[model samples]
Each structure stands twice: as C-alpha cells, then as structure tokens.
Target: MESSPQVYVKAPPPPETLGRPFELMDHHGQEVTNASYSGKWLLIFFGFAGCREACPTGLVSMGAALDALGGEAGQVQPLFVDVSMEEPDITGLAQFVSNFHPSLVGLIGTRAQTFATVRDFKIRREYAMANYSTKETGPRINHTAYLYLVDPDGVTRAYFDHTLEPERMALTVRLHMKRRRTSP
Candidate 1:
C-alpha cells in the first residue's frame, strides 16, 4: 500500500479578503442592503440568540468599544446579524440583541435569506445531530467568531478575533474612519 501526503488547513481566508453583498431585514422590519450602509462604516458580526459564550461577549465588547469611541461612534454603524436557525423572524432577533446594546441593530431574515448571508460572509457553522436538551446541557450550534469592519464602499476593511480588546477595536475603527475621510 502507498501513502499519500495530507495537508491541514484552517478556515477560509479572512473576511476582509472579500467584499460580498448582502441584503437582510433589520429588527424594525426594514430592508437593509449593502448600499444602505454607504457613506458610513459598518461593524458586523454573525451569531445566534442562543449563543451563551462568544456571541454575547462579542456584542458586549463591541458595544463597549463603540462607547469608547464617543462622538466617533456616530461615523460607524454596528450590526448584529442573527444567523441562528432557531430565530425565523425579526422579533426574536430584536429581543436577543436588545439585552446587550441599545444602539446595536439586529438583523434577521428567512432561513434561506440568512443562509445566503452566511455563505457570502464565509461564516462556518455546524448543527449538532443529537438533542442535548434531554441531557444535562442544551442543544448547541457552532459558528465562527469574527468582527468585520466594512467601509462605505461595501468593502470589508478589517476583522477581529476573540483576543482583540475593546480599546484597540475602537482605535482601529477611528483610524479606518480617518483613512476613509482622507481618501478621495
């Protein structure tokens, strides 16, 4: 028997490597497209309502980061994309994100719509086949954790992982905003 060489790879390229377009409804039932964010910066994250660890913490850190920016926050828009399979409507998305930040906009759509966004964003997600509610723990859906910064031109400029601090995040956002302002 012959052996073949195997290669190990991680996730897809960083989200900033691509500028995919997306269209989804906000919590208020308003349709928001890539163009809607034109002329402003967009901070986007994909997570579900039932996420107990990374999602909520990321949202909190984002809100704190924006707060740290003070007036500069107005130059950016924070969007929490609810990619949870459990939430099929805008109401659930709204209620989920409301607990974190007042200004954070929660986005939701049909399963197909959400799946489309997930695919475009290159977000990795997995569904557990076993029902954990019957056990000591609850059901779990795994997803990627990354905070993306999109420029006014609908281009992704940066992405942050779990180790990024709020202060650093805010500073990076300000620098990007400044660069955008200086550019033609």
Candidate 2:
C-alpha cells in the first residue's frame, strides 16, 4: 500500500520582546510602568509633541483604529511616549496626547530615563538641528515610526509600520487577539 504524503505545519511566530521594564510619568504626574498596564493590551508609540506630520498622522490613525474596534476598544490602551530632548512639560505633553485621542496616555521622563526606555524598546532616534548660520528651518527630530502591539503579558506581539492603514490595523489587532485566545 502507498503511504499518504506527509503534512507540514508552521509554528506561530514568537514575541519580538519578552517584555522590558520602564518607569515613566503620565501627563497627570502619575507614575506608570510596564507593570501598571499588566492584564491589558498596550498599543505603544514613541514620538514627540513637537512632531508636526508623522506623529500626528500616527496618533490620528491610532484613534481611528481603536474606534474601528468598537466594543473591543476597551480591551486595549494606547500610550504615547515622548523621547525628544525638547520634550514638553507634563501639562503640555498630556494636552498634546489628549488632543489626538482622549483616551491616549502620554508619558515623559528625564533625558536619561527617556534614553533608557528607548534603548530597552530598541527604538532609534536622533536630534536634527539646523545650523544657526544657515537659512534652513529650525531643529527637528528623526526617530523610528512603528506601532507596537503588546500582549496583556507585556510581551510584544507584533508591530505595524507607518504604511499600514487604520482599517488594516484594526483587523491585524483582532487577528492577534484571536490567536492568543486559541493558543494553549
């Protein structure tokens, strides 16, 4: 008798990060940490309040994506962490983040703390200052732009680049949630 062909299966991808600890202050002067968000999904983004285009776009898209999730929105929390040397004060940063999404939590810290968190998350960032003698525009910042999707356990489940649309983002998040529910 002829034997049936062997079947192959692919395993699920592992988390990008096992989870990194960080301590930051919210816009409200409240302390926040990786442990603070335990038992809840986290949609984290690193950007600055001074950013004009990319930051606004990412934040708006994040709000739209969360809205698209409907009732499931409550299951995930959005966080905006400012890593700029020109980081705004707590009040300003809070206002900036809230302007994008009322539910979005804004975080800020000392230069050292911000750098440490950036290193922990493996995010790339640099200050772009224009020469004072030149006619170029004022200084700005360059940094990695990605939306990190972290599971309730704090492990990074996946990441979405700047090119992903809001609708697709919502779908992607839903798929992750489904996978987690079915996994052993």
Among these predictions, the greatest TM-score belongs to 1
Instruction: Kindly list the per-residue Cα lDDT of model 1 for residues 120-157, writing each as its tens digit.
Output: 77888886676653421345667888889998888888
- Model 2 per-residue lDDT tens digits across residues 110-149: 8888888888777888776643214213356778888889
- What are the runs in model 1 whose C-alpha is more than 4 Å off? 1-15, 133-138
| Whole-model Cα lDDT of every candidate shown, in order | 0.81, 0.82
TM-scores for all predictions: 0.85, 0.84
Error (Å) of candidate 2 at residue 95 is: 1.7
Error of 2 at 117 (Å): 1.2
